[model samples]
Target: MIRKFLLAALLASATTAQAHEVWIERDGTGPARIYLGEPGEPVPEGGDPEFAKLKAPKLINHNGAALVRKAGYLEVAVPAGDVRAWDDAVFEPWGEAGKKESVVYYARAGRSETRAAMPFEIAPVTAHGDRFVVLRDGKPVAGARVTVITPDKWSKGFIADASGVLRVPVREKGRYLLSATQKDEGAIAHPSGTLAALHRIATTSFVVE
Candidate 1:
């Protein structure tokens, strides 16, 4: 009988400690309860650091109706060590009172996929410079063709290697635009006899001086 009574008391205490509540007040006007749950429980914060970063939807009061504004969204991924440095990035509107609105967002750091961008140096070489490799998702894109066009109508072309990288020679030092295109043959074909599918294209521009 004593053991049964002790177990009942322990269970009641545990239940009370597990109960928790979270809420947001409307401009500090009154106590408005938003959520209620137990502590140490996981919740979806709405930010993914793996593939891309997006702004969290904001809650607003427009003439007593809740309106959401999703403009002014910025997406960027920095190095792992510089994650905390983004805290100082101002997220609020700067000018014009009528254009300003409250902001709400969530951040995720220390993810494994975060890395630095590739660095390239441009200098005047001979009629053509050494070739460089390009990879997407760490794999070569074979059969991909790269083209470079200069301001004087000069152009050169190269094909990507098995590793998805292409090194082409650039003749003449001036503003140049580089573009690549690759088509997937296995894509679903449309009935109109014209290929209607997705193609991967990457383009970059640099000034050779």
Candidate 2:
């Protein structure tokens, strides 16, 4: 209960150290659209971290393409074969608006089935559907917020249990974006003041038909 309260406090904090979910969504073999901010809201046009800032989301495919994230959106070139992709990185800390903090963003999107074991990553534990497990440091992350975004731009939020497990019913028939976040209450010094750091992980998007 106490930990749940702390997670809520972290999400509801009124600082630039805001909790956010980022994902790359592709529609029918078309260009990918990267989204930032809370789910269900329209993807913003600016003020988003770029590939250089997010430490570059890695894409494993032919030629080992040079990918980039920009304008709160990233255009990805999908190769002509099954692929596994992921961008799991921690960025340099920044401060502003009387808040100091750091961000860790990670996401996976592709056709490959082998889900890489990642620190602070989300994995599908069920044979199918929207069930998943939230992992941090290779362990379960309980009481995390797992939000889902449908291709129609509608979204609903869900929570994980003590085992960091979540099962969200599939309600749409296009594409799906699953995301969750965790906070590290232990803070560090900053020019503005002491700040609490937050870590967020993006799911290797699942689909429902």
Candidate that would win on TM-score: 2
What C-alpha lDDT does candidate 2 achieve relative to the native structure? 0.59
Q: Which regions in candidate 2 have their CA more than 4 angstroms from the true location?
A: 1-19, 28-33, 44-55, 58-63, 68-72, 78-92, 95-99, 110-116, 187-196
TM-score, every prediction: 0.32, 0.64
User: 1-209, model 2: which lDDT tens digit per residue?
Assistant: 99787656654543433445556666555555555555456654574443234445555453366555567665667753333344433334553434546655666553334243456667776545466777787778788888877778777888899998888666768766777766666665544356675445565565554
* Cα error, candidate 1, residue 35 (Å): 47
Local lDDT at 175 for model 1: 43
What is the C-alpha local distance difference test score of each model? Answer: 0.32, 0.59
After superposition, candidate 1 runs with Cα above 4 Å error: 1-130, 185-196
Ten consecutive residues with minimal summed lDDT in candidate 2?
81-90
Winning candidate number (lDDT): 2
Mind giving the per-residue lDDT tens digits that candidate 1 earns over 23-140? 1112112212122121123323431121022223222221232323222222222222211111101122121223221111112111122221211111112222444444344444
